[model samples]
Target: MGFFSHTEKLPGNWPSRFHHKCTSKKCTYPNSPQAAEGRYVCLGKVNGSPCKGTYEVSPSDAKAAAGWISREVEREAEQSKKLMAHLQEARRRKDDEHLQLYQNELATYKRVLQADAEGDIRFIRQYIRDIDSVALFEPERWHTHLIHLREEVLRLQRLVRELQLKTMNT
Candidate 1:
């Protein structure tokens, strides 16, 4: 009520006790000739003390108080709504940023794992080729060389499959 900026106006309708008076109390006027002749004093007490405020019963004063109070209430409500909307948007933006960062980290980890697996496969193929070349010159060791090569190839294939599955799961 104190924050409201009052303005002058003409007479208007008598809307009941929605506006605050001094100490939350309202004004009163007696049914007498003096009431029609003079201004009405607000009976509301301020800070536990009597209020000295007075206003005429004319339409101008009533309309002015009502209009000022209405505008202040509307302005405050709009400001509150805007503040809540801003907070919600900020939270949504932060959540999106965190999600993007997590996705980037996951992608980087998968790429490193894929590179390691490819390197392992490359080394296994080269080792198998080296053994085959030696076996061609030593015919007595051909069977043993093939068995060892097959075991190593099987192990490397299983390792590659496991790496693929790991990346897929995460």
Candidate 2:
């Protein structure tokens, strides 16, 4: 039986595949290892050929992977908090366009958080890639953009008020 064939019986809802960098010299293939003979072995292909790289599995290696996953979840949670703040500001300003954008972003973040909490590594990874592909994961950029929009809205409001006053005097 192959290593991945028995992955459904593994404990802790671990992912069926764990990605590890190929250690082969001058080989740049991205390696994904599955358990074999009590250790993880690379099963990746290079240029349509099988890769021969191997990685030894250790307790510390498992711990490091878990830690990395936890850190990603935490970072996403922090970004969600920032998104909530932006959503509230959008509501206060009655800015429907930004309000809708923030709402959609928060919904996506919620799904990512839920998948991470349920230990669905595959879903989380895919979702993250989808987000990264669109370059929408930067909370700092969103914050700056919101500030600029707010300034423009205020400037336009001031212009309208000035026009109203001029018409009243004429």
Candidate 3:
């Protein structure tokens, strides 16, 4: 597994796959006279594959490879986070035209979702107000529709925020 830095070794089981016998005389695993029979645990990649231990890497090479992988993972994480923040800000912006479109869509959604006689007259009034400029809509009624539209838009925005928060937490 890759990480942004040298991960703390987990305690109680500093384990590794069986590697080759150590060549260094100071190395305990290979100090036996029959060094070829000695066992080892791999701590690095080999033969262009991972977790299939069959090669021994120089300590220097393993450290370098680990560092490279760590930096790459960190870079990717930073980029992904920046992109998500931008998308979230764009989603939250309140543009009237976009809000109107969402209002129309919400009306349709309400009709499909609500299974009762409360078919939402508020939707029809708002829809008419948007399309008809000459129609003399009651001022109080029109104002109430605008207020309801704002409330509905806010509710949808909150739902989107909740979904985003849930995804990020996971």
Candidate 4:
């Protein structure tokens, strides 16, 4: 058994800044670069001996990485406010089905907002990277794409509800 025995290996060759510290005992190295085959190799020395220990690369400065996530949260909160208004309209119209759907979607939005606030560095970084790539490739269609995605989700939800109702009846 080892320190990383229960842990899965980390993928990719991330930069030194992304890595926090080495996990080897008594070897407080700052970063561990990936080997040729993608194993993290510690570059620390312990009492005149090469540490050469293998450890998972913990993320450095999660708060720093969460800056984009904070801005995204603000944007998502505004979107959720619109969703809340829609939910209110459904209530006013006494649309039970739509109200249920809106409640479910609002729950999902709250869960996502909670996750964003918790600041998962890897997820935040990947999300920012993906959004940046989309904006770069399809500058004009970015907002339209988001709108289409929301519509698609609503359509899918309705379809799923219809199927569930049919199944219950059958």
Quick one: best TM-score, which candidate? 1
Tens digits of lDDT, candidate 3, 1-170: 11112443322333322223333322222111111322335334334433333234445445655565567679999999999998866665534345556557666545523422355566555555565544335666545655665677568766655655654554
Candidate 2, residues 27-48: lDDT per residue as tens digits?
A: 4444444323235456767677
**2 or 4, greater by TM-score:** 2
| TM values, all candidates | 0.36, 0.34, 0.30, 0.24
Report the Cα lDDT for residue 116, model 3.
Answer: 22
RMSD of each: 17.1, 26.8, 15.0, 25.6
Better of 1 and 2 by TM-score: 1
Candidate 4 error regions (>4 Å): 1-132, 136-139
| Descending-TM-score candidate ranking | 1, 2, 3, 4
Clashes of 1: 1
What's the lDDT for all of these models?
A: 0.49, 0.54, 0.47, 0.54
